[model samples]
Target: MRYWLYKSEPATWSWDQQKEKGAAGEEWTGVRNYQARNFMREMSVGDRGFFYHSNEGKEIVGIVEVVKEAHPDSTADDAKWECVDIKAVMDVPKPVSLEQVKAEPKLKDMVLVNNSRLSVQPVTEAEFAYVCELAGVDPEKAMKG
Candidate 1:
């Protein structure tokens, strides 16, 4: 499966709120950027994503699984965007801050490092594993859990 990084302003949609949704998952809506919407459209069920807290924490706080593929975004007024259902998989043992990510030489090519404004972005499998490692999370275990 593909990997992705999904950002949210914690003030708007925090990791706690996602966990609260549990197995049912929550609609990842309100994405207005065409590039971000396209990324959502490419997602498949079971794909994993890093749940990043953008404004407040500016860190990768947890993991989420795409339980439902892209569908019409109910929060959108027009039919130009789509969303997916994602459930919290697990919390990062040690949240990886943006500062840390920027500092990590291995993450130099990461989209989050190069284009921090992109709300929904793709992550390489190697980058994903590295971030999980830095966060004290076992990548495989986190995915399975």
Candidate 2:
């Protein structure tokens, strides 16, 4: 499974709000960027993502699993836009802040560090594993949960 990252403002969609959606998950809609939408199209069910709180906490607070593949975004008026459904998997034991990520040599090449504006972006397996390690989570076990 591929790894990804999803960013959201805490006031708009916090980690707690995502967890409240439960197993049914929630459509990751309202993404207007073509590149971000394309990334959603590439996702498949069971792919894991880091739920990062942007603007406020600026931290990887939790994990999410894609429950549905790309589909017409319910919130979008244009047919060109699409999104995936993701459910909360588990919380990051130790929230990994953006500052911490940037300071870590291993994550220096991460897309998040380079392109912080992208709402949805790809994450390398090595970066994902290392971040999980920093967050005190086992990547393998987190996926199983």
Candidate 3:
């Protein structure tokens, strides 16, 4: 099971919106950057990603799971890009803000650090576990309601 990070602004579509979407999930679309686009194409059903809140809070708020494979991106016609389905898994008890993440030396190499604008990025298992610990949430508690 691979892990990834997906970003969204709070006003447009926040963690709450995803949680409210319930089990059905919603397409993760509107990604325009080529790098972000590539990440979206690589995502598969059953893959998990961090539901990160960018622009507004700039923090890692919760986790999400991909429920469907890649498909056309709604933002663009002609299939210039694609999107995938991701549903809210669970919120971190304590949000790991960009500030907090940057403060930790152990997380210095995180994609959220190296690539600030990358909407979709990979996360190592060690980084994931460390984040769970920092947020005071069990990794197992992240996948279900």
The runs of at least 3 residues in candidate 2 whose Cα sits more than 4 Å from the true structure, single-residue gaps closed, are: none
Alpha-carbon error at 24 in model 2, in Å? 0.8
Give candidate 1 regions above 4 Å deviation.
none
lDDT of 2 by residue, 9-57 (tens): 9999999999999999999989999999999999989999999999999
TM-score against native, each model: 0.97, 0.97, 0.92
Could you tell me the C-alpha RMSD of candidate 2 in Å? Answer: 1.0
Evaluated at residue 67, the lDDT of candidate 2 is 97
Candidate 1 C-alpha lDDT tens digits along 29-138: 99999999999999999999999999898999999999999999999889988999999999988999999999999999999999999999999999998999999998
Q: How many backbone clashes does candidate 2 have?
A: 0
lDDT per residue (tens digit) for residues 39-93 in model 3: 7778777777788899999988988898987889877866888888898888888
The 10 consecutive residues of candidate 3 with the worst lDDT sum are: 136-145
Candidate order by lDDT, decreasing, is: 2, 1, 3
Give Cα-based local distance difference scores for all models. Answer: 0.94, 0.94, 0.85
lDDT of 3: 0.85
Instruction: Output the better candidate (1/2) by lDDT.
Output: 2
TM-score for predicted model 1 compared with the true structure: 0.97
In model 3, how large is the Cα lDDT of residue 52? Answer: 89
